[model samples]
Target: MIVVLIGYMASGKSTIGIILAKKLGYNFIDLDEYIEEKEKLKVKDIFTLKGEIYFRKKEAQYLNEILNEENRIVLSLGGGTPCYGNNLDHILNQTGVISIYLKAQIHTLVNRLKNEKSKRPLLAELENGDAVTEYIGKHLFERSHFYNQANITISTDNKAQNEIVEELVLALF
Candidate 1:
């Protein structure tokens, strides 16, 4: 089985996926990192060089590749992964693929992402915490439709990493 972790930026998908994979003895694959390794460039570089349209196409292709080929793995998707192309439909149609959305509040996401904006291409232009909060609020509103389609949804606010993982394990089993 493949467990796919889906969420907005700074929603703890990668962090939770690593721990969940460890607990379940499954390989952990962060789709962004996988893309960087395959493309020989950072995700930000991909956006700067080839552009988001190109990146999204490659991301969809690579996501299909991974879904078709991997097993017993935990996959962490990019923030916009499901919101693009036919990614969400493809994921839902796949057998043995379990999708989990790590839902986080706007304030929580703003607090978590404010310092890390430089690393995020989408959030890079935002100037301050207020800006980040506003961006996330709007972005999350748009993306929540895709995210809410996941087989499971776990709220992550005010929870420890281990607690989230534990909740994930229970949800899975």
Candidate 2:
């Protein structure tokens, strides 16, 4: 089975995904990192250089490639993965794949993402913690419709990694 973890930035998809994969003895792949490796550029650099349109096309291509080719993978997706161009439908319709959304409150997301803005190209332009929080609130509101399509939704607010993974495991079974 392929377990696809999807959520907005700093929602712990990658963090908890690694743990879940380890415990399940599945291969772990962070889609952004996979793109960076394949494109030979950091995701930020890709956006700065080739632009988001190019990046999104490649992202969809790579996502399809991985889904068709891999098994027993815990795949951590970029925040916008599901919202783009039929991607969510692709994941949902694919055989042997289960999509999980890591749901976090706006405040929880703000706390986790505020300090990490520099790492996120989309959030890099925001000027303050308040800005980050605001952006996340609006963005999450827009994206929730896409995210809510997940087979399982797990809240990560105030939860440790192991706790989240435990919930995921139970949800899976």
Candidate 3:
């Protein structure tokens, strides 16, 4: 089966996904990393040089490739994967795909992002102060509909990795 992990930035999708894939004995594919490897460009560079639309197009193309892989995989999709083009629909159409969303509170996201903000292209250039909170709130509100379409949602706010993994296993199995 193909387990697709979707969620907002810093929502633990990648973190928990690796663990889940390991436990399930499935290959782990991080979508963004795959793009970086294939295109020989970092995600931040892709967005900076080619712009979001171009990056999204590449994302869709790579997602199509991911679907064709023969091995079972737990794929960690980029935060905006669902909102971009027909990627979400393509994923849902696959009988083996199990979509999971990692949901986190705005405060929790801000806290987690504060220290690692420099690593993310979008969040790194924020206007400071309440900018992070405002951004997370607005972005999450806009993406909630798409995120909610997942087959399962696991809350990561104030929870340890093990706790989240346990919940996900229970939900998925």
Candidate 4:
């Protein structure tokens, strides 16, 4: 089985996925890192050099590739992965693929992302925490439809990493 972790930026998908995979003895694959390795370009560089349309297409292609080929793995998707193309449909239609949404509130996302804005292409231009908060509020609203379709939703607000992974294990079993 493949466990796919889906969420907005800073929602702890990668972090939780690593721990969950370790606990379950599954391989952990961060889709962004996988893309970087496979495409030989950073995700931000891909967006900058080839444009979002190209990146999204490649992302969808690679996502399908991973879902079809991998087993006993935890996959962490990019923030906008499900929101683009037929990605969410692809994820839902796959047999043996369990999708989990790591749902975090706007304040939680803002607090987690504020200090790391420079590392995020989308949030890089935002001036302050207030700006980050407002941006995340709007962005999350836009992305929630796709994210909410996950097979499981785990609220990460005020939860520790281990607690979230424990919840995930219970949910999966």
Candidate 5:
């Protein structure tokens, strides 16, 4: 089964994915890392050198390739994966694939993203706290439609990793 985790940046998809995979004995694959290794560049570098269109195409290809595998695994998708293409539909059609949205409040998201903003190209460009808040709000408004299409949505606002993991385990399987 492919348990795909999706949400806005810093919503804890990767973090919760690792815990869920470990608890369920499933392999965990962060799609961004996979793309980095394949393209031989950091994700930010890919966005810089090749452009977002190129990166999105590669990401779709990687997602298609991984969907063919038979192993039970959890995949953490990039924030924009579902919003931009046919990726979400492709995922929905595959058997044994359950989509989980790690939904977080805007304030919580801003706080979580503050420290790690440098690593994320999109968030790195925001000028100030208000910018960050507005950025998240606008993007979340745009992506929430696709995100809400997930089979299960877990609120990660102020929640501990283990607690979220427990909720996922009970709700998913």
Candidate 6:
């Protein structure tokens, strides 16, 4: 089974994905890192150098490749992966692939992302926590539709990593 963890920035997809993979005894892949490796450019660099349109096209291509080839894997996707093109449809239609959304509240996301904005291209421009909070609130509102399309949705608010993994494991089996 390929378990794809999807959620917005700072939603703990990568962190929880590692724990979930360990629990399930599956290999883990972070899709952003995968793209960075393949393109020899960081996601921010890709966006800055080639533009978002190019990045999205390549993102879709790589996502398709990974979904087609991998099995028994825990894949953590970038926040915007599902909202572009037919990527969500691909994940939903694929056999033996379970798409899980790591749902987090706006306040949760703001709190988490405020400190890590430097690492996230999308959030890097915000000047303060309040601004970050407002941005995330609006972003999450827009992205929820795509995220809610996941086969399974797990709330990560006020949840410990292991506890969330336990919940995900329960949901999967």
How much does each candidate deviate from the true structure in C-alpha RMSD?
0.5, 0.6, 1.0, 0.8, 0.8, 0.8
- Give every collision pair in model 2: none
- What TM-score do all the candidates reach, one by one? 0.99, 0.99, 0.96, 0.98, 0.98, 0.98
Q: Candidate 2 residues 1-173, lDDT tens each?
A: 99999999999999999999999999999999999999999999999999999999999999999999999999999999999998999999999999999999999998888778889999999999888888999999999999999999999999889999999999998
Looking at model 5, report the run of 10 residues with the lowest lDDT sum: 63-72
Question: In model 2, which runs have C-alpha deviations exceeding 4 angstroms?
Answer: none
Tens digits of per-residue lDDT, candidate 4, 9-121, equal 99999999999999999999999999999999998889889988998999999999999999999999999999999999999999999999999999889888878988898
lDDT of 4: 0.94
After best superposition, candidate 2 residue 60: deviation in angstroms? 0.2
Residue-level lDDT for 26 in candidate 3? 90
- 48 Cα displacement, candidate 4 (Å): 1.3
- How does candidate 1 score on lDDT? 0.96
Q: Assess candidate 6 and give its TM-score to the true structure.
A: 0.98
Q: After superposition, how far is residue 168 of candidate 4 from its true place, in Å?
A: 0.4
Candidates in order have lDDT scores of 0.96, 0.96, 0.90, 0.94, 0.92, 0.94
Model 2 TM-score, all chains together: 0.99
Model 4, residue 81: distance off in Å is 0.4
Cα shift from native, residue 16, model 3 (Å):
0.5
lDDT of 3 by residue, 129-166 (tens): 49999999999999999999999888999888988988
For candidate 4, give the lDDT of residue 86.
94
Q: Predictions ranked by lDDT, top down? A: 1, 2, 4, 6, 5, 3
Q: After superposing candidate 6, which stretches have Cα over 4 Å from the reference?
A: none
What residue runs in model 4 are displaced by over 4 Å at the alpha carbon? none
Ten-residue region with minimum lDDT total, candidate 2: 109-118
Writing each residue's lDDT as its tens digit, candidate 5 over 37-59 gives: 99999999999999999999999
